[model samples]
Target: MDSLNYLYGFGNEHQTEALTGALPIGQFSPQRCPYNLYAEQFSSTAFTAPRATNRRSWTYRLRPSVAQLGFRAYPLEGLKTAPLNLVTPPDPMRWDPLPLPSEPTDFIHGITTIAVNGNADAQHGVAVHLYVANQSMNSRVFSCADGELLLVPQHGSLHLDTEFGQLQLAPGEIAVIPRGVKFRVQLLDDSSRGYLCENYGAALELPERGPVGANGYANDRDFQYPQAWFEDNDTPHQLITKFAGHCYLTELPFSPFDVVAWTGNSAPYKYDLSRFNVINTVSFDHPDPSIFTVLTSPSDGAGWANLDFVIFPPRWMVAENTFRPPWYHRNVMSELMGLIEGQYDAKQHGFSPGGTSLHNCMTPHGPEAEVFAKASNDTLAPQRYQDTMAFMFESRYRFTPTEWAMQTPLKQSDYANCWNNISKLFDQNDKI
Candidate 1:
């Protein structure tokens, strides 16, 4: 990938050009673009949405997106859609990482849907998927008309070639590919595996800080957007589109990443997890996990999010005479947690890198018996929780497991036993 030149500021209107003076100044959509490039505006929201929340970008490209001759339906292997419901009682579940693909696979081919919520066409809820790829997406570009993809790499590194520019990401990092952005993922290592969230609601934005004051959690300066880069190749390449829960193939005699210069708030961006401005309690109680939210897709209801991308990064623990582990409780939102690296404080074992645990809405989840015992008796001295990174995909709706997710050998059937080992400590409560 070419060295990236970025336009700083998140959700801010910005202009950039790979070639010097290639961007038209002062206005967008000029009658004749510089260098005779075609101009196009990609709108992520309705044109009349609030100015502060509106997202769109102008691209000066050698060819517009319409250059494809036509779109034909392509099979979406094992990909599932919404309205999936199950009648069983909700349970706290855990699963080891899905085995890496035995057969050769690329990013698009390796994705296997684990669960979905809301309707993609209706633009609500989200989809959870696990991807394992041993090969790169060569001679092809992929576009998701369903929603923007929030990619979390758990293994290997990714070099993304997008219509707007190129971005490279590794484990402990994330990339947000805007809805309808065409891009291809290339493996920078031997193989790749990761978590993907298909957000079908409003575009994700930095969460409101609320009472945390002006700072904490993810900061704007920490978010990085790719600078303008374009493909000028006329070689044949395939373009795939995931639209309305189906994949479509489009043959193009040209490359789609042909934007020479572009500017807009609706573009691909990435953020390093290490850069998150972590917030924690300074006094007695543990703050809600929402305080760690990096981004949220809000719904019509206030304070309710269609999806919340929250993380547990290394931070200080200084609460006075309190259990350091997260308190046990049932919550309104469903949570799917994954460990990217190191050990999560809540689980002493079973939850490892690439492993996942699911606690649906109103399902009880917290530290296992061992973790509870450890935190309950440990001295309440100032300590650092270093060498740990975990994250969660929280949704307003409950998650329905896919057939594969249900029957997979990786499923830990004894996951609930972790809590069973907690002995009766209440008998001595009267004496205390």
Candidate 2:
């Protein structure tokens, strides 16, 4: 909000203070903090994690977090957890845009789990959710004790107030908030709708560019981390925590975001998807979609990822003679794709904006029959794909959808019809 000052760099140890001389020199826990503030440590990673990957923040706040009364069980409706109410249907699935609720809902109440993988208790998987809200959160905060969240707004804008600061985001942009960061989501337009990936594995990091070198894809500088800003309020507030796949509530006399100064790499950051540096073939053949990865949550195994956040943005198709659309085949990774705007080259017919399509592990999925035919016969010319933004949450583990996701009205019943008309093109008698 306040002119949007930010500290740039991913995983860089950053320091910011709301007031002058608020941060003490040389020590994280000084004998006494400036302005008689309380010193606290908020750790995002385990204490024994590698120094390179460890994430902990030192915050100087007016009151310690102990100001809250004991937490009580708070049952959140429509939000399901992994391995519960999940169906392993083998058929490829697609869904239309989620309709806004008729009843008034805020961000927290609007969230509905679509699918979940891995385990929150083990912190090794992810849960995908759809959130649509018509009202703003009033003095309410949500923090995930299980893992971090990668939020993508597909409809209206969102004014996200976090412990770090306020981040304003719209469609084609994303905000990644590390676990345990208290924040509130308020509708910026008439309503706000979005997708959220609750990652229970390692925190998301920028994908490495091995041969592509230092520049390409999402740059670290483009990731905007909010500057220091805090709310010094005494009004009663509600705080909710998602721990062990269950929601818990705590009522505090003041806001949890009362930090006056903080320094840590474990902070929330936002990036505009338009800033991704596109890299495509100037010669022939389409590269693997891994080249489009913006962020990744790496598993312990090599060449395997817990989750890959990939995008198919506007780029040039200048290959000399090649099938411009994606090649047909299914491998190991399960893909959950969402379109933010425009038509996807693979499924121009049924995949609409705010919609999602899925291809489970080793399932046959590619361009539709019409798209395949059109791209196969296209001329060899440099084409600029414009006004399109689609993204995928690909994972090594298969995503089992909840009952709501499988039975919702938005679920397209005839999704397989697009691929049902693949004709025998190789049986040429008069052709060629």
Candidate 3:
């Protein structure tokens, strides 16, 4: 037998018969070699190790060999591939509130801005929105679009109805909805809501930890995926999809929320905000607002971020010889801030809860006259800020005032007056 013949199962004359259609072993022999070894050798010798097994007739159909199936078992290539169809929800859909009958159950009203009509043009974009439920209406449905929707519920409990199933999100709970899914929200109690991020890039993935390992903010187990909810409702309904800048609504003859059975990582989920391991300074001054940035959309402009959604939640305000409130300054990114509850340390009175203020790109804002005076003269003791939660939706794009925002009576007439109080504190000797 030659070396090639020996490498294969073909040895001598007996193997030659096995190479033909005849069985390798005769009636006396117990073991029955299915294919003639010689023919199998002849057919497979031309191929490589992994290729040879695939070319084998019996082996090809029986099962893939270890080398041939290794890529399948270890899907490194698939894992590294980028996601297809990355999208952001329309900002207008967020403004549209679903009116429900008055009741005492869990009901909340939420307004989303970043998830609205924002687009990601070679950069990630973040949207800011709010939720206000009078504790009268129990729930509202949120039909998710073709991208990830991160819900930073500032206040109240949210019962999420997702394709997978339902999840109860309390205050400080952060939920993420994958693209192309429909879900609803049920307030566990009457509460106001504030959210910051609207991710348009890769799904709002858990922040990566290099070397340091898992040490801070939002662990994986803290995230809760809804249980499976399988329903067969054949009712006609509209499926609204937001792409580019417009909304495309398709009417389906059945409830689009129908996900009778699905099991995958690509589903809507929620996480507790309290679980965030807040990173802040204990000694000198307040860190940049970016510290509270639950998520950031990176921009092509070097270190500059496209959008940095920041929060000013109730926290310890105890930095000696330092102005406790956000230091007065103008920011390059446009800022749209909303007060969910309590007094904003920056403004003493006019910017009340539920009120909004816009500091367009490069506009100077922060610490109106009264707030500055109080903070400058007050004693520097360890003070715990209580009952206050304010959030900002900072974006890179220059936001043009919407016709409704600019023309509607809902616009605060006294917004410009917020700066009027500054003149009262101007001392002739304090500055030239």
Candidate 4:
């Protein structure tokens, strides 16, 4: 794949030695293009070309790309590590297991480390919640104003009653409920369970193919979209909606999930993560982490991203003269990493499945003593990285640490010592 280069700013010509490059623009052609003195009123100009006008709008101008956008791009300070913000910690005292509604309809209930409180501190755009229930019933109706909801099953199977009709969601399967749409989950087996990611922004989109061409990573056809299904049942059904940090229940005469026969670009869908086309370097070095990105919410600024959801799945590692694992570096975006299973290659100790680590914007984090020693001593060869699966919830905003995350007993106390062992590698005679 060719390196990606961008041309920002006006009045400056930038050239990319790489074959793949993008020319950023400040204004659209035909609207803001330089007018020709001797040509007809509609004569085409360099800026008036159809391609130029289509690529950019007249309201904004282009600028050059920088390694980092600088502090002015973000509102918060303390880029390295923002203090944790924990307004509502997990309260087992508040854990109230509600019985399924006695009515013959869909119902959901469970406990979560994070509550469904409407407070800003309690409600993240990506609220992680757990769900469990028994018996199958009619699908219930629910909607989110902020973003889509991802149902990640940890156990059991779910029969989803969606606009696309009845569908079964088994363990390891993920269902996506788009924002503003109504849907319900019914347990196919005796017991059902899972984790939920309530996305509060743009829907998860396919990453651009760029120079990699149409191959590698997730392909568009691999995505499964549900067909339309609508129900005409008329009864007093409650429709619950979450908006602006508050939950509102509205009594409706029929199931809101009923979309009898609607067809459009907007609809709920699901996909198997296993189908993702994993990309890696076979010879010299590891590729950019972005290669593993499943979805990205680009920032208002061009090129830079607001949030990028990257995954580290099991794959082969065959790089030569490379560390094979991720190299150490401070990032501009705050990274919140979570493990689903197996060990992460970067941090060999402390980080475990179900555990989380936050490397706030610009905070340095990498391999611990154990991983470094093993990598330094291991013979270079074609290696297969197996049984490991991890993910990162990276955001442009510096994470305001939750007090619970910082104070929890689960927090590793010896994390700071991971870098202490590196001092042994320094030598005065090695100074250049």
Q: Rank the candidates by TM-score, best first.
A: 2, 1, 4, 3
**How many pairs of residues collide in each model?**
0, 0, 18, 16
Q: Provide C-alpha RMSD values for all models, in order.
A: 1.6, 1.5, 17.5, 15.4
Worst 10 residues of 1 by lDDT: 1-10
lDDT of 1 by residue, 1-432 (tens): 335666666788878898887788888878898899888999999999999999999999998777778889889777776657655358898899977888989998888887777888788989899889999998978989899999999999999999888899999899999999999999999899999999989999999988878877788887888888877878898988988888899899988889998888899998889999988888998888998999999999899899999999999999997888899999999998888889998888898798888899999989889888889889899999998899999999888877788888888999999898888788755764
The residue-by-residue lDDT of candidate 3 on 10-68, one tens digit each, is 11111112123333333322243343111112121124534312221111011111111
lDDT of each: 0.88, 0.88, 0.48, 0.52
Error of 2 at 142 (Å): 0.6
lDDT of 4 by residue, 285-355 (tens): 67878899876655456645555677788888888877777877788766766665678898766665555
TM-score against truth, every candidate: 0.97, 0.97, 0.63, 0.66
Off by over 4 Å in 2: 428-432
Off by more than 4 A, model 3: 1-147, 152-157, 170-172, 186-202, 205-214, 233-235, 258-264, 424-432
Q: Candidates 2 and 4: which is better by TM-score?
A: 2
Candidate 2 lDDT, 178-262, residue by residue in tens: 9888999988788888799999999999888898998998988888888889998788889999988889998988877888888
lDDT of 1: 0.88
